[model samples]
Target: MSSFLTLSIVQSALELGCIYALVALALFVSFSLLNIADLSTDGCFTLGCAVGAVVTMAGHPFLAFFAAMAAGVASGFITAFLQTKMGVQSILAGIIVNTGLYTINLMVMGFSSNINLFNTNTIFSMAKELSESEVYRSWYKIIIVVCIVLLVCVFLAWFLNTSLGLSIRATGDNEYMVRASSINPGFTITVGLCVASAMTALSGAVLGQYQKSCDINYGTGQVTIALASLIIGESLIKKGSIFKRVIFVVLGSCLYRFIVAIALRMNLPAEALKLVSAVIVAIAISFPYLKEKAGFYKHRRDVMRQASKNV
Candidate 1:
């Protein structure tokens, strides 16, 4: 128990949570706002990692972010084009893009399965050099990740309220209504997906730098994790403005990480973490429905008690 409460453990969980919060935010945009289930998230995430790793290894750490985002935009564009122009279903389009991205990712990694950044300079390392204090150095990773998460939250708030953003939202709510209002649902979807994928790629870019390595399997189950985080956030913040909702998405990611960290501390094998994630996802997905059912049953029971008293 005491080991679980260590500052190092907490910091690690928080840093990872913040990094993954970007993925959650991406899902929030595409899944919740735009009503699109992008199954390419896992592949897109690895694409970001591969691109970022290659760029950083080439002596341009900062450029890796933009490069990764560009790659993500391209991936999203292909998926969108398939759905909008090639008459592919959204799910099928995502699957096709995802499958293709695996080959591309391997090529980006020079046909290798992994890339190590053991001695490479990354954004985290750059931040660490800005301060001389040991405490500052120790917390640099968390500071950078938190700052990025905050910036992304602010961006989501501002962007989602814009005219174009509103169009995307409306397109998700009712494609016919948006089309009747002279807005192109296809265009809105393309823009929304591209933006969301950029965020997801950014998350992967950060994670690659933080861990100082990129693995082919690093992105596996990313969509499930992001979906679980988004659903957990929505369950926690049932009614709020968009900004508040986005903020809670970060919180949810942190909470999920804390749970996993605790499980690890309790002697659970690493292999079991996937099962844990699956369980969390199932619970998060079903929570709202279960809550409504419980409420209905309670209401009926109360009504029966009142009628019995009157009789």
Candidate 2:
């Protein structure tokens, strides 16, 4: 175990963890804050990768991020419009958008299954070139990802406290109440989903640049990954301020990546990793309920024993 758990392994895990945390943060906004299950995450993520890759290859590595986010915002608006105005169910709306995004993503990739950036400059490469110290140079990727995560966390924490942000939270808690207050629940929902999708796309953009390649299947199972990370974070933190919650979500992503790293070191086959993720997600989601049931049974047993003694 010690042999495989080297510093390089830890650093690699941290980089990936921080990058994926963006998606977890996105889930926090859509699922936790807005009470919406945006199933378009998987497709939106790939769309970001495709868009970022295309833009970066066009000599605009920095601009790729904004382009990808804009595409995601558009996707989110469509989903929101379908649900809020066209009377489609939220889940069904997400499904429709996700289905359409596949073709769109392919088109963005020039109908190709993959785009390689081996000869193209990426954000990570730019960061590497800008690093001054040898130590920092070695960790340029980590520095980039960590800074990005910190910025996102701080932005989300601040946004959630603003008036519009509060309204979005209210819409999540009770749309009827928001409507009663003339808050325009539809508008809040649209804003919430748009922001969430933008974050998700940004995550994909970073990942694409980090890998220096983008595949059509790059975002497969991203929804599961984000959901699992979010559940794990919530399970651990339980109750906290918005800032604390968002911070722990990043930590949870790191921990999840660490677990996956250890699993890989266990000589497990590649196919078994998905199963491990599923198990982890299931356990994380059910932990609170299981703990509650256990406590209830223990209390009942103690009460019965006390009654017997009294009798």
* Top-TM-score candidate index: 1
Which runs in model 1 stand beyond 4 Å of their true positions?
none
Per-prediction CA RMSD (Å): 1.4, 1.6
Please give, for residues 1-311, the per-residue lDDT of candidate 1 as tens digits: 37547899899999998999998998888889888899999999999999999999998888999999999889888888898899999899999999999999999999999999988999888888898999997888898899989988999899999999889889888877986799988898899889889988888998999999999988899999988888888889888888999999999999888878887888989999899899989998998999999999999999999999999
Q: For every model shown, what is its TM-score relative to the native structure?
A: 0.96, 0.95
- Lowest lDDT 10-mer window, candidate 2? 1-10
lDDT of each: 0.90, 0.92
lDDT of each residue in 119-147, candidate 2, tens digit only:
99998888788858989887989989999
Return the lDDT, model 2, position 186.
Answer: 84
Model 2 Cα shift for residue 89 (angstroms): 0.5
> What is model 2's C-alpha RMSD?
1.6
